[model samples]
Target: MPAEFRAGERVRVRAGDPAGHTRAPRYVRGQVGRIVECQGSWELADEVAAGVAAPRVEPVYTVAFAAGDLWGEGGHEVTVDLWESYIERAERAERAGEDGS
Candidate 1:
């Protein structure tokens, strides 16, 4: 399967504050990072999170985020595999009330 997200791309970790179930870690919320690799699509781990029983096709992307971009440099550099379901475009013009990008 071709990876949905490519390298050198900045993807946003999904922010689930009101609706939808996700497996993204809280530490990664609203953070920006560059893609390292695509781990293909897999079943969503939402079942392990809450009572949400929706299985989703989640593409995994290896990402590296600077501590300054996320929290601060005082924190160590963090790398994580984020799911596509938990990923979104930064400054999403569509989600930003513009065209549906």
Candidate 2:
């Protein structure tokens, strides 16, 4: 199956303070990042955490974030692997001079 997220696509991590076991890191929550790679599907963690017998599956992706975007300047860029469910489509501005519009 095709990956839910594609490389070069901008996506945002779901923001919330829910009480439960989750794979998404707290530091990345609500942060916008570009998908660097799609790691394919895997067993959903939410189902596992909920104790479901038949675990659901979802695509996982490696996302890249600029240091300045996540933290103040002088920080280095970082990347994290996240599940599809942990992120949502985020609108991104066109690259400069790409469209020539």
TM-score of each: 0.68, 0.81
Regions more than 4 Å wrong, model 1 = 18-21, 48-54, 74-76, 92-101
Give the residue spans of candidate 2 off by over 4 A: 92-101
- Total clashes in model 1, counting residue pairs 3 or more apart in sequence or in different chains: 0
Question: Model 1, poorest ten-residue lDDT window?
Answer: 92-101
Tens digits of lDDT, candidate 1, 1-101: 45677887777776666355555678888776678888787766765466557655667788887777577565666789877767776665633453344
- The clash numbers for all candidates, in the given order, read 0, 0
Looking at model 1, the pairs that clash are none
Which predicted model would earn the best TM-score? Answer: 2
Task: Assess candidate 1 and give its lDDT.
Answer: 0.70
lDDT of 2 at 55: 82
lDDT of 2: 0.83
Q: What is the per-residue lDDT of model 2 for residues 1-101, given as tens digits with 9 covering 90 to 100? A: 45877898888899987678888988899988889998989988878998989887889999998878777764677999998989998743543333365
- Residue pairs whose backbone atoms clash in candidate 2: none
